[model samples]
Target: MTDTVADVTPEIAPSSYDAAQRRSDAIWQKIESDPSGLRMLTGDRPTGALHIGHYFGSLRNRVRLQQAGVETWVIVADYQVITDREILGDIQGSVRELLTDYLAVGIDPERATIFTHSAVPALNQLMLPFLSLVTQPELERNPTVKAELAAAGKSAMGGLMLTYPVHQAADILFCHGNLVPVGKDQLPHIEQTRVIARRFNERYAGGEEYFPEPDALLSESPTILGLDGENKMSKSLGNTVMLRMDEAETLKKIKKAKTDADRQITYDPEDRPEVANLLTIAAQSTGRTPEDIAEEIGDRGAGTLKIFTAEALNAHLAPLRARRAELEQDPGYLMQVLRTGNERANAEADETLQRVREFMGMVY
Candidate 1:
């Protein structure tokens, strides 16, 4: 939601969009019929605790993929976190706590592999050759990278930030991922990953296809903005509904969230971002449409809307919060989950790295 969408004045190809639509449609058409499932790569940066946004936007999809028998990889993107922050802060602490939330949210450790970025040294080994495949301008042109830097008020882009797309390419290619479940903001990253895969296969495969060009499987997730309605829900922005927030705290934050003076509940996203955001939260949590929620409220005022929204969010998050707490109490068990996942991830990544070495004639 916070991503800065670039102007598409130059990309005015009708056939290109037509082709893309067909490809995207084909991917979803057999999602249920196909039992083999996809090899998916997705996760969060361990900057802080995840919130409702993370749950709906990503974690929910991760759980679904795991249940569908997909080979899912959940990355604690610790390496990407350092690109923005000057200090490491409490990264290990954040990773441990977040892993608990991941498990509590239903990403079964047995099905989905979870690992930190730095822990997978095999991923780092692909960086050099992958970097060679991409041009500097392509790196600079990544819309997500530009948006992240601008949002953070950063004037100069760090080397890591500039090359983050390349790092992402490494992340996906290392695992031989074919489907990346992501929000609309992250589509471009997957497209970049495709480009990398194509380049590597062509250059090294000697007329054979070695890598599967990954496709973006966009989630049908409503864009959940922050309480301020001015930015995406972010823990650092102090405007997130934390996944672990107690009932009282969650209600308190919703009560203070921005709403208009119109008093009537309408899902107007453009003019009333705040009201639209609240409606989105309630509707998604309660399994109803925003229009339905608004119609039921029927001019009951923003107060009623806020209460309904908060209660719905609380109802949804209660079990999850409790589960996270229980997991947190048993650190040894949670650590075991992560360790097992890390081993799985390392083995997969190492296998891919060895293949790349053999293809490049470095296996002497």
Candidate 2:
């Protein structure tokens, strides 16, 4: 176990963003040219049903990468559910729902590997060696770990909470995943994973590269603010529209979303954030600019804006919702897909573990 934080560290290393962005751009080109050369690991904790924020945030990018021929591994991260939460709320159901959401968003089982954390023992075994590579201070200083701990509202954190970043490193290296899709806030976690990979190679692999220093694939999508128009859209905040919501439900949520009293709708994000947020949602759905959308809805109050945003969002989600409905009818297929993924991941993790053991001269 590790101790709690008495002080804060820089959330992200100041100079790393430019370098990360440069590498990300170059990696994007490589992916476009030869996607088969790269393996990407990206996923969500089974906290709850995904919302439109998730859809635009990362799920859409995952679908794009899968379609682009990148080898993708989507981990359910079921074990991570315990890192912050005290009560294990319906995790089993959340796992199933996450699978459905992935498939519903076009993550083809045939193209991507989707597995849960607890299913692969060999992968978790990598944690022991990886943990040894870093000092306790390193773990304590990790910005992601600190932020997560603060979010959980705990004055002191457990070992799992403190070492969450290391576990993530194992998740990537266990499968030798080279690219991780993330937002800027998550870059520090990727940096920590890279450190673990480099350290392991130096210490046990005799300065030979055993694990690839995974690069952060930052999301280019604009941040999707919650309906409150104040914070990022999150399920925990109760300010997001779930992907499974019907048209009526979506409309109800959107109608209740916050917007300013300005009679003439505009797209000035700095000054008119609330109204601009609604416009952004409408723009993303209808494939138009927020400015253009606002112009079309000129002089319309929040009531009309809400209706327009809801209609556009619903229309965009109509196909996905229909696919989800069909999938809901056959629960067995979803479970089978997970079982198959788990088998494949276990095989991969086993091979990686064997190599790690050999590298450290623990093969006897």
Candidate 3:
């Protein structure tokens, strides 16, 4: 919330944190002053349905920027979904669920352009030129690549998997996304985007600058944790309170969520992740701080904390669930939204690719 957006990742270099946080502050301040002109790119991979972690980390910021008249583009990154073969096995179902979550979370079809990545061929074309611009060592050096490999539990990955960040650069630049709202863990990937953009401009455009260097727009909310309290809330991990969960189901999940046995709840993420996770959830749900929530719940037992958390969580998700239900019942309508978004996104992608091809002398 302050200039010091804490880098929760212990492995991140301090210099990296400082540079990213400073740039993030500048981007946030500029956008806050005049959001109308800013173009934003943010979205999910559709590897699975979005959950509370997704909501607090980036989805909420995407909605906020779109509502503020930022030229917002959200991608259901179907291409990225296949980075893991296991994901490719069920991407179709996951894409459907992803669309439902996007609509459920108030990503207005008319406001923010939300499209499937595969729908925009022009964007994908940009990646080929970009791949040559970045080196294998550069890709291997990316912390996000390491993190992804670690998360996927794969020591061996494919060429495409290794160069996925290059694909992301294509995604951001194709839209001229000057503002990329993401959590801290994603800053490294955005940094890679910045690098690729810089390299492309230097190599092809003679550093005159064609693509905007996208900055990480850190959300005001701290990173949301899973119910297990040990890791990030993830659908893959089966620790998520899904965005479109019904009231009763949401409460049931929250009730079963891990919490400390402490009688008096305290907001200590480092020491008490479960209690802190609940407190953070309650804060986001009620527009209060975790510290404030902890104070309000003084002397409250874990049972009371669970009750309050469930109520807050359900209240926040109630309208979203209703919207999701409406959208799910009309699958044809959801597909239409993606199609419309694709049309709009493809127009922009074509323009970007035109410029890029000209720069690369591929205009024949």
- Greater-lDDT candidate between 1 and 2: 2
Reference-based lDDT, each prediction: 0.80, 0.87, 0.80
TM-score of 3: 0.93
Q: For residues 77-189, what per-residue lDDT tens digits would candidate 2 score against the true structure? A: 88988887779899989988888888998999998999999999999999999989888998998777887778668999799988888898898999999999888787777
lDDT of 3 by residue, 191-213 (tens): 88888889888999987888878
Better of 2 and 3 by TM-score: 2
For model 1, name the residue pairs that clash: none
* Alpha-carbon RMSD to native, per candidate: 3.0, 3.2, 3.4
Using lDDT as the measure, the top candidate is 2
Give me the displacement of residue 182 in model 1, in angstroms: 1.5
lDDT tens digits, residue span 257-287, model 1: 9888987888889999999999999988999
State every prediction's TM-score relative to the real structure.
Answer: 0.93, 0.96, 0.93
Better of 1 and 3 by lDDT: 1
Residue 362, model 3: Cα distance from true site in angstroms: 2.0
